[model samples]
Target: MSVSQPYPQTYPQQGAPAPAPGYAPQPGYPPQGQMPGQGPGPMPGQMPGGQMPGQFQGQPPVQPPRTPTMAGAAERPNLLHALASESTKLWTTRSTLWLLICATLSMPVVDFAISSHYAGLDQVLRSQFTTDSSISALTALLLYVPLGVMVITTEYSSGMIRNIFTACPRRARVLTAKTLMLFVGTLVTTTLLSALSLFVSHAMLPGNFGEPVANSDVLTTAFRCGIYLTLATMFSYGLGAILKRSAPAILIMMAAIFVPFVVAVVTGAAPGSLGEKLMDYSLISGLLSQFNPQDAPATGPSATGILIYLAIAAAAAIGGAYALVLTRDT
Candidate 1:
């Protein structure tokens, strides 16, 4: 026993916890210094502590943004560009110009012809115009409502209203633009019609064909006609947007304007029929009756009041339209 034979032996290192059988030091991070089973530190003559640190040791590199297009690309547009675009669309469609031409050529001829045919109308307009002087009298009954159907209902029929709405996303803006376009377009069209009508009337009755003497009032009638037509177009456009259909909307509009009067006429037993007063609330009648222009035939409601009503009706229609588009699927 004095010299023990060589014995197999294994033991833990001093001051270190023994690991379980399969465990090893984690990768990347050394234990405390050079860690277990590692070689000696910075070796001979190495500094005790690391001497220097590199810049941005704890951060990542920043990258610059690269884009194909920048903000405010191309150039801003001007008024001419906008108008040219509008006009291009306005005239490009054969239907638009056709409608314009139709209204232009039709109204004045109908005006002169009807007035000529019914000599009684002239006396009536003169007496009622001078006596009553309401805007309702000047639109010459409700015949103009059907004319308004041509103004915008055709767009509904042809689906051009969608294109118009697409180009003009904001309903009110497009409505405004359309109103302006209607005003301007009808201005030109009616002016031509007026000229043509005057020419024909003078030729027909020469020195007496409603001779437009100093303050003869033809100019007044013509101006009122133009304004009335423009308003009618705008009113119909709003209705088109709301209904997006012609027949039903047309019937509704007609009823809204004419029903009160009809109801009064049909049941004419009471003290001037209670429904007669309700006619004042009619939007179609109000719009068609706007703009008196003193010398023109008189009708119910002053131009100012009629215009106010038309504006209110337009605003309500526009609001309803906006709500519809916002909530609707398409």
Candidate 2:
């Protein structure tokens, strides 16, 4: 059977808010199906498309927002309340927090446990450490994607997305706020994991990373990795908003991340040139290659590369999302 489309009914536009009670004008307020400025009145579609306007069709006219009868302007959301709200929302629900907790605690424990195995032999250990640690970092990220995606998909799955959209109304603002929260969450989680890893490595292994490179390079790499992982996680929110279903997005994600390598392996004996070329352009290769630039040995794209890739991913997922949100019936 074919995969079902996410937007079977209607969709919205980018930056638009949710359909509200005339309280606010959303970005995707008027859908393409609704001809601009012709909604309150009749359209000439009686000659071309033959579709009548809302008023002509006896539908209720678009009413202006009701002014607050009792009070002054509504107070803005306070910073403390906003922070608490975002934090509570980020941590309370679903499996994501649990996954994060596990990741946060497990990395150090595992790394420390393995410290002894590679200790003492500095040369073999250094080469091994550099390669394995980079891969290990990526392994951490791939494992984290599902939980990150869940941060968004859970809203849709439980129908809370509609509630969220309704409450906030400004879809872009809501999404942006959510993204900010998620980014913060990822940084917190990644930092926790990184710290734990360091603690474990130092306490358990002590001399794992080799003769420390220039402080600048080390800090730069770490900073870049943090941002990479954070953006990757934020991207999942957009993906979930569009896909709505967790399973399909995960499937697509796996394909985007791993299928290229699989393709190369399967074609290994067919033609060396074609197989190698295919792998070179593969999503996994391209994504991972960014990190290992010039054979420096790392586990994340350059800050710039990650930013570009994240942008592309966000555009695809979020673009489809606004379309369905704006035009489709709730």
> What lDDT would each prediction earn against the true structure?
0.52, 0.61
Q: What are the runs in model 2 whose C-alpha is more than 4 Å off?
A: 1-84, 120-122, 195-214, 269-274, 281-291, 296-307
Give each prediction's root-mean-square deviation over alpha carbons.
12.2, 25.2
Candidate 1 positional error at 191, Å? 6.0
**What is the per-residue lDDT of model 2 for residues 1-330, given as tens digits with 9 covering 90 to 100?**
998769666679888976634454459677445566666434664423344443455454456898875446766654444456667887887587787776565555566556666666675563443233444456666766777688777777888878866766666566656666777778776755554454345445545344544444434444555566666665666677677889987777767667767877887824346666556555455444433445521333443654576767766766676677656644
- Reference-based TM-score of each model: 0.53, 0.63
Question: What digit string (tens of lDDT, one per residue) describes model 1 on residues 30-113?
Answer: 554554566755544444343223325444444568665654575554444445555675676565666555655564455455
Clashes of 2: 17
lDDT of 1: 0.52
Tell me the lDDT of model 2 at 260: 66
Q: Which candidate is the best by TM-score?
A: 2
Tell me how candidate 2 scores on lDDT. Answer: 0.61
lDDT, residue 48, candidate 2: 34
